[model samples]
Target: MRILHKQQHLPPLDGPRLEPHPFRAAGMPPDKSNGAPLVPVNRREHGLEARRTDMAADQRGEGAAVNTEHKDGDRQPPHGAHDAFDFRQLGKEDFEQFEALLRYAFQVSSSEMARIGWSDREMKLSKKPIFEASHVMGWFYKGRLASQVVIYPMEVNVQGEICKMGGITGVATYPEYTGRGLIHSLLAKSLEYMRDQQQIISYLCPYSIPLYRKHGWEIVSDKMTFAIKDTQLPARHPVEGQIERVDIESEDLHKVYKYFALQEHGALIRGALEWEEYWRWDSDDVMAAVYYSVDRKPLGYVIYYIENEVFSIKEMVYLNQEAKYGIWNYISAHFSMITKVEGANYTGEAMAFQLEDSEIDETIQPYGMARIVDVQRFMEFYPFQFSDPRLTLDFEVKDPIAPWNNGIFHVSWQDGEAVCEQVATCHSGHRIALDIQTLTTMLMGYKRPTYLYNNDRIDMDYHLLKTLEALIPPDKPYFSDYF
Candidate 1:
C-alpha cells in the first residue's frame, strides 16, 4: 500500500469517516493546547508518537508543554521512575515487547509463540516491514510497553443499517501498572483518533464495565450463556442422522460451518483469516473438533474439547434440526467421560428443552458490552415503522462520563416508523433521565428501563417510562465473536 502524508489524497478502504472529539477534563484549558492541535494520524500520516506525546502532556497538567526528551538530560529512567511513567507509541519493531506485554498482561501461556497460527502470524506481520501499520495503538512507559489498546477499522449492522465502526481490543495493562491512569491516557488518545477518523461508532469487549463508560461509550449488545445437563439428553431423536468426528485435515468441516452461518442470525461470516484464528488455538489444551452427519456427509460442527472432564463448548453451529440433534447427541453421549457442556449465545429456544429430560442449568453470562459513541448516528440507524400515525416522546440520556450523550432526544413516530430529535425540556408530559451507561445496558435487553429508573440511574415520568420501555425492542443482544 502506498503511504500518503497529506490526507486529501489516499486510496479508499472500508472504514468509517471520523470526526475529531477533543477531550477537555473539567477545569481543563479551553485552548487547543493538547500537543500539535490534534493532527489526524493514520496510514496517510504516521505521526502517532508525536501525537501521543502532546496528548500525554495535556493529560498530565492540562496546560503543561510536552517535553520531547526522556526525564533528565540523558534518556535514563526517572529516579522514582519505577512508578514514574511516560507514554510512547509501540513501533512495529517492538513485537517481542508487545508479545511479552501481552503475556504478562493477560497471563496466557506461550501458545502465542507458535509459528503458524492466524493470530500468531498477525502478531508477527504486525511487526514486519510489509504489513500496513494502521488501526492499532499502544502505550509504553520507561522503554517498556505497560498498557496497550488497539482499534481496528470495521463495520457493524446496527438495527438495520450498516454503519462504519471501530472495534477496540487487546486492552491489557501490565500487572504493576493497573491503577496508574495508563489505560485512561491510552483510551483518551484512542477515542480522539477514532473521532478524527470520523468513525461513527466504536465497540469493545470490556474487562470491566464502569471504566469504559467514563470515557464516552454505551453498551449496545450482549450475549446469553446457556448450559445443557447430561440428564436432559432425551432418547427420542427428531431427525435421522449419524454423528461422527472428521479428521482435522479434512475439507468437510468448512462446508459444515458455511451451512451454519447461512441459518444463524448473529453468526459472523468468517473468512480465511477468521478461520485460521479460530483453529490456531492449542487444540491439545482446548479440544478443537468438528461434527459430521451419518451418511458420511458434513452437516454440523463444534469447536471444543474437554477440560478437566468438563466438556466446554467454545462454539457449536448447526444449520438445521438434524444437524443440531446429531451434534447435541454426539456430545451428550460422552457423558460418561464429561461432566457438562456449556456456552453462551442468543437462541430462540432454551438448550435444556430440546434434551431428553429437559433438566439442565440455564446460566446466562452477559458477554461483549457495547457503547454508542455517537447517539445521533445510533438513533439514525434505528429501524422504525414509516407507514403509521405520528407520536412524539422525550428521552433524557444522562451520560456523565461522556457528556455528549447526556441530553434529551425527542422521538417521533408515524406509520410504524420513528425518528429522533434533540429537545431541552418536557413540560406537558412524562419525563426521564438515565445515565448513558444505564441506557446502554437497557438497549441490550440486559435490564429493563423501568428497573434502571427504579434504581435511580434513570428518572422518568410514568407514561414516558412506559414509552421508553415500549421504544426499546425486547430482544437479547447477541455478539458471537470477540474482535
Candidate 2:
C-alpha cells in the first residue's frame, strides 16, 4: 500500500500522549510535574493550548516541538522516544496512498476497483469528490501510513426529528501495527471530535460485532432478504399511479427518496454524496422505473437489473400505498423475462405474505450497529410523546465507555415535549436502571423497555417500565445506507 504526505501546517499532537507500552488507557493524559491532570482539549481548542504548551516547553529547554517528518520510507525513532509518529488529516493529494491502503484492507482487486470506477487515474482526476479531507484521519508511523479511519458526516430521522450522525467506515490497520492499539487511540480522538461537532450518535457496519461492541456500539436494525419464483409474485392490483421506465439519473428518484426518508424512522437523511454512492452501479444493465400519478407527479421508484432470468431489485422506495402497489405491478410485469426475484427489506418482516406463495425463502440478518456518543445531548432532542397530564422519569444510566453518561438523569414530559437533565443526586427505587447499550437500543425502538426488563437487560418497576414504554412511540427502525 502506498503512503503519501503533502499537506502543510499539520495539527500538533495535542491529544493524549502515547506510552511506550501498547494498549494504554484511552484519554488518559500523562501526569504533570505537579502531579495534577492536564485538561483535555477538543479539536478546535487544541490549537491555542498546544501552541502555548510548545512555547513553554521550548523556554524550559525541553524542546517539545511539533514533528514535521515527511518521507517515503520507514525511519525508526531513537529508543524511548515518545513522539515517533505524526497524526493528521489527509488531503486529496494523499488519495493515491489512501486508495491503495483501502484496496489492501478491503481486499479490492485491481479489476474490481476498475469495475467500480476507482481506477487510479480516474480517481485522481475525476474531481467529482471522493471524501472530505478533514473526515479522513491518518496515523503515520515513521512517515508511513499504518492506520486510518473515515467519519462520514450524516443525519438520521430519530422519531420525527433530524439528529446529526457520524457514520464511521474504512477503519483499517496494517498487520505490523495490529497490536499497538492505534485504532483505540484513533477512535478516542474521533469521539472527542464528534462531541465537539454536536454529533451525538455514530453508526458502523462492523467487520466483527464483538470488536465494535467493546467500543460502545450495539446492533440497532435488521434486514430481511427474500427470493421468490416468478409464479409466487402477487397478481397485479389496480392503483391510481402508472409505472413508467425512467433513467437512473432522473431527479424524480431523489424526490421519492426524500419523502420516504422523512416518514421512516431510523432512515438516513442522505445528502448529495450519499445519493451518488447509492446510485453508483457497476453494471450497465441496471434500470430504473418511477410510479407516477395521472398528473405526472412521481411518488415512488425502483432500481433493478436482470441476469440469467434472475431479477435483482437493488432498491425500492415509495411514499404511499398506491405508489407501492404500482411499483410491485411494474416488477410483476417482468415475470415473462425473469424466473426469480431477490430483494431486501429492513422492516424485519418477510414479503412472502404479499406473494402468492407464502413459503418463499427469506433470510433475516443484522444490518448495522449504532452508539449514543453523548447521551445528554441526544435526550435533549429526543421526541417523546407526552400523554394527558404530565410524566416524570428517573434513569440511572451506566456507561463504562463514556463517563459523561454514567449518572442519574431526570426526564420530565409535558405537552408532547421532554426536558432531560443530569442530576447530581441519585433516586432510590422508582427509577429505570440500564447500561448504555440497552438504553441506545431502547430509545431507537429496536427493543421496548418492558421487553428488556423481562429479558433481564434492565431493572425497573413494572408500572414505571410501562410508563416509559408509553412515552416512546413504536417504530420499526430502518437504515438503508451501508456507511
Candidate 3:
C-alpha cells in the first residue's frame, strides 16, 4: 500500500483495549449513539433530585467519618447525632475488611474486587506496595470498615506537560448509611488530602456521573469501540517486517513506550515502578506479539487473545505503517481461527478512513474527564502557540468542584506564547463564560464554545466564541492510559 510517511520504532501501550467492563458501560447514557442527552436542569421548586440524593446517600452507614456540622446554627452535628467513627489509610491488614466494604457497598463480591485489581485471590492486589497504605483509605465505625476510596498518585502527560495526578477509585459506602452524606464528606476530605500531597489534578472512574459532577468533576475523554470486519482491513504496507513473541517481563516494550509518550500528548508516564504494576495481570487470554524491522529493530507490539471465536485485540501499538500492517497480517493470516478483530483503536489517525470499506460499526465515546484545579498555574504551564499577534480572550470559569477555580481569567499572548491573569471583568473585550464541565469538553475537542453557547452551556457572543476557539490550541488532547 502507499505510504503517507514512514515512521518506525513506535511504542507499545499506545493503542486502546478490549470492551470495557459492564460497570463502565453502565456509565454511558443508554443512548450512546446520540452523545450525551440534554436532560433538563432542576428547577429550584422541584424539590430535591432523587438520583443525586440516592447517590449522595449511598455511602452513609459504614463507619464513615462524615463531617455533619452546620455551617450556621447550633454547634451540634446534623440530625442530633454525634457518634465516633475511625478513619485511617488501609493496608494489608485490612484487605479483607476493605474487600468486604466494597462488596457490601457496591454489591460486588470480594473476588470481583480482586478481579478489578486484575487478580484472582480475594485479598491479593496488583498495585505497588508503596501506594498500598495511602491508596486505600477506610472509615471504620465500631471497628468495622464502612466506607473507602483508593487514591493513587499518577504521572500523566497532559498535552506534552508531564503532571502529577491523583487517581481516585474503589469508592464504596455501606448501604445502611444511606442519606447521611458520608460519601460527600469522605470525598471532600479526600480531595483536601490530595491537594496537600501535591496532586494538581485528580482522575476517577465514577460510579455515578451526576454524583461526581456535583463534586465538580467533568467528563473529559471517551473510549471508542469498533468492530473490525475482516474485509475492512487495509492492504499490507510495502515495507517488510518480522513478527515475534516476547515475554511481558522484558523491558523492550517499555523502552519503546517511553519514546512514544514524549512525542504524543496525554500519554501516561509508565515509569519502571508503574510498569511492574501493569504487567502483574494474567495475559493468558491474550497472545504475546511484537513487530520489528527486518533489520531486527523493535517497532510495534500487540497484546491479545482469542476466545469464543472472537479475536479480541486487547491493545496494540505501531510506530509506522509497515509495523501496523505487519502485525495485522499476522492476525489476519490466522483468520481460520478468528472471526472478527475488535478493540480500541487510536493511532493519532482515523482507522475507519484508512480501512478498505468505511461502512462499519465504529462507536466512540468519552472515557475520562478533567478540571483545571488551578487555572492560572494550568495556563502558565500550558504549552500554547498562537500564529497571530494581538490575540487576547477572557474566560469566566465556573468550577463547582473547587472554589479556587471559580472566577474570571484574562488570557493574552505575545510572540506566539501565552499567559493568563485573573481579572474582574472583560472590559468590553471578547468574553466567554462556561462551567468547568463545558470548559473541559472544549479542551478535549468534544465540543466547542460556540456549540456550548448554542446549547446554553456557555454564554458567549459570536466574536467571543471565535476568540475563545482561537485561544484554545488546535491539537486534540488524549489520555494514553486508563486509571
Candidate 4:
C-alpha cells in the first residue's frame, strides 16, 4: 500500500469540536503520477443560470434594516390573516427566551447537559457575553420568537489580506414556524447588514450542506481527525529550543497567533472574545505549553488535556520546524501516562508520513462553508496578483440570492491594485460567466477557475480562462472558530 502525503496551500469551539490547524509542510518529494488528477467540487448540482427575478427590485436595500414594529394589545393574529413577522435585534433582556428557544430547537437533554458539565445557570451566564457581542437577530410572529441567527464580526486572512467576515451561528426556528421561510428572511437580512458593515464574506458550520447551498454557501475547508496510539508517536527530534508550560491567558500566545494568522491564508484574525472562546475548557484539565528559543522568544504553543489515559490535543501551532519539533518532544515526554493521542488537524496534510508507525486511524471530514455576501465589495478589496501588471477582464455573475452581485462586471488591474466595476454595456462574447457560489469557492482557493470551467460550473473562452487562473492566487481558508 502506497501512502500519498499531499501538501496544500494554507477555531475553536467545543460546540462541535471543529478546530483549525497550521499550513502543511512543503518541499516533500512530489508524487510521480501521470499528472495531477482532476478533482470534482463537493457540492450538490444546482442551476447556475437561474436568476431570482423577485429580488431584482430589492437590490438597493442593502443598508436598510428590517422593519420591526411593536404592537400593543394581545399579540395574536386574526383568523385567516397572515402573521406579520417583525425582524429585530435581540438584547440582554431577551436572553432567557433566546436560551429556551435554542434549547428546545437543538434538543438539549438533561443527561447530555450534565455530561458536558453545563448547568442552566452557567449556560445562561456564559451565553450573555456572546449575545452582547454578536449581532443577534430574531423573527417575531404575533410577538413570539419564531426564528433567530447570530452574526459575529470577524476578520479572516484571505491570501495575506485581512478581510472582514461575518460568522453566522445559533440558527434555530420553532417547529410551529417551520417551512414559513422565516430563517431565509433572517439570513437575507443578515447578509444585508454584513454588506453595510463592509463584511465581504460570510461563513457558517452547516447542519445540512444541501440546504445552505440553496442560499449560496459552499464548502471552503476540511479537518482531519487523528487517533494515534502512544507507540505511534514520533520520536523527539533535537532542536535549539526549550518547552515550558505557560498560562492560558499569556499575551505571548496571542502574539504568536497574530503572526501566524498574518502569514497563513484562511486563518482567523482572532479578537479577545474569540481567544476566550478558544480556551473555554476546564482550566484544571487543560494545560498550555509554549516552545521558546535559547533567547526566550516564543515560537509555538500547544493546548492539550489528559483524561483516563487518553491525551487529547485541542490545538498545536508552530512558527518554524524547530518549534514544531520542540512541541512534539514535549508531547512525547508524556508517553508514560497517555495510552493514545487524539486531535483535529485542519491543514489537510498527512500526519502518518511523519509518524514512526505509518498506520494511524485518521478521518477527513468536510468542516465549514463560506459565501460571498457582496461580490462587488469583495472584489474591491480582493488582493489580486498579476504578473503582467496591466490586465483586464469582463465577466457576468449570476447571483439569484443576492441580486446586487448579478450582471456584468469589468475588472482591470492598474497602479498596483485591481478595480472592479459594474458596466452598463460589455461585449457578450468577451464576458466570462459564473454563478455566485462557484465564484466564492474559486476566490477562497477551495477550487480553481479552470476546475470550475471544466466541471461545467463556469463558462469562459480558453485563453481568457488561463488568464483568469493567473490573476487569482490559490488560498486555503482555515476557519477553526465556530460561532
Local distance difference test scores for all models? 0.53, 0.68, 0.59, 0.71
Model 2 error, position 37 (Å)? 48
lDDT, candidate 1, at 275: 57
- Candidate 1 local lDDT, residue 157: 44
TM-score of 2: 0.79
Instruction: Name the weakest run of 10 consecutive residues (lDDT summed) in model 3.
Output: 67-76
Which has the higher TM-score value, candidate number 1 or candidate number 3? 3
By TM-score, rank the candidates, best first: 4, 2, 3, 1
Residue 245 shift from truth in candidate 1, angstroms: 3.7
TM-score of each: 0.65, 0.79, 0.75, 0.81
What range of 10 consecutive residues in model 2 has the weakest lDDT sum? Answer: 63-72
lDDT of 2 by residue, 272-377 (tens): 7777666553466788999888777788888888889988887787766778889988888888999999987876556877766899999988888888888877
Error of 2 at 193 (Å): 1.0
Q: Which number leads on lDDT? A: 4
For model 4, what is the alpha-carbon lDDT of residue 152? 88
Taking every candidate in turn, the Cα RMSD to the unseen true structure, in Å, is 14.5, 15.9, 10.5, 9.7
RMSD of 1: 14.5
Q: For residues 1-483, what per-residue lDDT tens digits would candidate 1 score against the true structure?
A: 111122123344232111211321122222233123222333131122443354344334321001110111111122454356656566667667766665555554446454334465565553342113345566566677766776766554443234555667666665555545555556666766766665556777666554555554555555556666656555645556666565654566766655444333233445554454455444455543454445556666776667676777776766556676677667767889866677754543356655556666776554566666556545645643232233455666654334456678766554444556677786425455555566556764556766765555655443344445555655444456665
Off by over 4 Å in 4: 1-82, 281-284, 387-389, 428-430
Whichever of 2 and 4 has more lDDT, that candidate is: 4
